[model samples]
Target: MLGNGLLKGLTETARNFFGSYVDKDRLTTIQYPEERAPRIEASRNFPFLVYDGTDPQAGLRCVSCLICEKECPPKCIFIEKSTDKKPDAVGKPQFYPTRFNIDVSVCMSCQICVEVCPFDAIKMDNDFEASATGRFSDLLWTKERLAKSNEYYHHIHPTEAADVDAVLAAARAKAAAPRPPAPSAPGGAPEK
Candidate 1:
């Protein structure tokens, strides 16, 4: 009983070692640059801001609500709301983030920012190649560097992006729908 656990671990190691030689499927190691494993759809590395269209500044989905910044466990997210308002994706006048930065060195890739964002403006990017020589300055990603188009979001996360698009379409439809005319006051009200 004492060495059973150790024996099991050893057995697994031996099996894997022998299996790698016999079975190609059992081989886990790959040449780093030339050959790489297929990326998992659910894999997420860091946070990036999602924008609607061509113009990163004008089409930004983030309303600069500061929710992500407040909710981030590591306090890596920073945002500065703009003084003037800009029309968001839904054509509503909303304050856009004038200054947004995320310190990747400090961020733990917890996806809390993406979860807290109500506007669907923030999403986890699968780009894991964020290595930098300098820890502080090089890793601090700015709004410009972090802004990615909706198409890119769809490419990285198809299912989730499609769902988000459907919800947004419904919202847009609701906003565009006409309102019923206001009823006039009782007949005699205007008769002096």
Candidate 2:
């Protein structure tokens, strides 16, 4: 029965070979570069910053916390907190990054930066076609280049974006709600 396994494998090969004509799914081989396979949602290549509004610089959500930079295993992320203040979506003054860079050549794409980001400012990008002629200069992405709109984030990660939106909405609602006046001192008496 040692040859039985070999025969079974050959049978599968024959079925696939013959089925290529009748079954569209059976044809796995294709002309790449002209026609590419669809990328799955979970596939991660590099980390990118997400912005909330039209202006990438003004709408940036990174509070310059440096959490992602500290957590990155490959030490590919770099950031510099800006001295100037900018109002965020909530109308609070926040410090945006003056210079944020990621070295793609040294980056291992481990998704650790995405995981460690508390602000949800960092997310793994699905783009894999980053070809650079010069490794050091061309491969380095700046803050301007790394920032993508929330819509772009939604386009790339719909499910994750939805979840993040829900959480943000809840937080905004909580922040916007007026706090109930502190209960009057015991027995409806005001204490000095």
Candidate 3:
């Protein structure tokens, strides 16, 4: 009876060996490079920021709030706020960022910058093709490198990007809408 149990196990193994070949046609093992593979949209592997180009400034939505720089675990973000003179006054601190940089080599891509940005100035991009053969300083990304069109964002993550756009549009509409005219006055004559 003990030998009979071993014989049953061997039979099961043999059955499995044959089943593998029998179901080979149903299996999907793509040959790398030779056979192209389809990518699913929900996969998130890279980090990038989305820019709205509608603005005349080429649409850098970051307000230079320094939240991203402060929250960055690695302190990869470098920002330089610009000093602009007021239109009516003589001297004033405009606080517009004249320079912004992110050391991509050190960035962990944790998406924390994207999450903490109150202005939605940053988002995770799907571009994982960044490579360079130079010093660490060479990998430092400037604002120019990070900027990406809003359309590109929608193309990468259509559902999520569209939802965010819809919300933004609604908020803008509410802000732009004029307030209702004052209830006419107490009775008929307009109140001064």
Candidate 4:
């Protein structure tokens, strides 16, 4: 019986060993660079910010709230708010950030900045091609460099982008629609 068990184990091991070569056509592992790998969709990653290029004030979404800056654990965000001119207009604080910078060298890609932004101004990009040599400033990205077209975001994440656009469209429709007249009180009672 002991010998039979050992023989069975050997047979199973040999089968597994030879099976790989036997089914080699089904294997899909490709050598990097020599063979191109399949591309991953952007929604596989967490959300990030994007700008709408056709809008002249695309960057206006980032109200200089500093919420993202405060929430950033790496302290990579640097914002210089502009001076406030008007005091009474329900205006967001006038501090237009003269310099908004994120040091890619220190970024952990946590998506915290994207999460806390009330304006939905910032989002993560699928682009991972940022590589350079020498100097910390070289790694620091400015607002201009970070701004990407909303169309680009839609291209990367069609489903999610479509959902967001649908919500915006519904909100615009609701805002533009006329309000219904208030219902009269039940049994002809005077309306409050």
Best by lDDT: 1
What ranges in model 1 sit over 4 Å off? 1-26, 89-91, 180-192
Could you give the candidate ranking by TM-score, starting with the highest? 2, 1, 3, 4
Q: Which 10 consecutive residues of model 4 have the lowest summed lDDT? A: 85-94
**What's the TM-score of each model vs. the native?**
0.78, 0.80, 0.66, 0.62
> What local lDDT score does residue 87 receive in model 2, on the 0 to 100 scale?
95
Clashing pairs in 1: none
lDDT of 3 by residue, 1-192 (tens): 669989999999888788779987745678856875654567654345565655423456666788988999988888876565222111222244567888887888788888898767688776655777877766987777777778877887889888888887787688679977777556687657
Report the C-alpha lDDT of model 2 over 1-192, residue by residue, as the tens digit. Answer: 889999999999999888888899877777779998777777888888999978887888899989988988889999998888889866789888889999988889998888888788998899888887886789999988899999988888889999999998898798889987887677867657
TM-score quality measure for candidate 3? 0.66
Comparing candidate 3 with candidate 4, which one achieves the higher lDDT? Answer: 3
lDDT of 3: 0.70
Off by over 4 Å in 2: 1-25, 180-192
State the TM-score for model 1: 0.78
Q: Tell me how many clashing residue pairs each candidate has.
A: 0, 0, 3, 7
Q: Which ten contiguous residues of candidate 2 have the minimum total lDDT?
A: 183-192
For all predictions, the C-alpha RMSD in Å is: 5.1, 3.9, 7.2, 6.7
